[model samples]
Target: MAPKAKQRRILVKLVSTALTGFFYTTTRPRLGEKLAMMKYDPMVKKHVLFTEGKIK
Candidate 1:
């Protein structure tokens, strides 16, 4: 018997800060995970920081 590994790859959403609630899924590492990234939004036509957390 062997222990199961935690999910190494996961689908996370990058949310827009413009309050448009626009989001898209991205692949990320689940181990020691702390993800904060800027992504482009078509509605706002600008980049916003998307953080990893329980979706609000």
Candidate 2:
């Protein structure tokens, strides 16, 4: 594979893995808050709350 194509594949895999982990955090609400703090955003916590049906 070309260098550019290989790099793209690696980037895609990394993004996919990170997204999977983020979704997993939603299943564990307490841990999700910690993970959200690590992300330096309030959105992750909001998403976790929404996913848990704590918010409409």
**What Cα-based lDDT does every candidate model obtain?**
0.73, 0.26
TM-score of each: 0.66, 0.14
In model 2, the runs with Cα more than 4 Å from the true position are: 1-5, 12-37, 44-56
| Candidate 1 colliding pairs | none
Top of the candidates by lDDT: 1
User: How does candidate 1 fare on TM-score?
Assistant: 0.66
lDDT string for model 2 (1-56, tens) is 66652221111111112233332223333323322222322434333221222311
RMSD of each: 2.8, 13.2
For model 2 the local lDDT of residue 27 reads: 30
lDDT of 1: 0.73
Where in model 1 is the C-alpha error above 4 Å? 1-5, 53-56
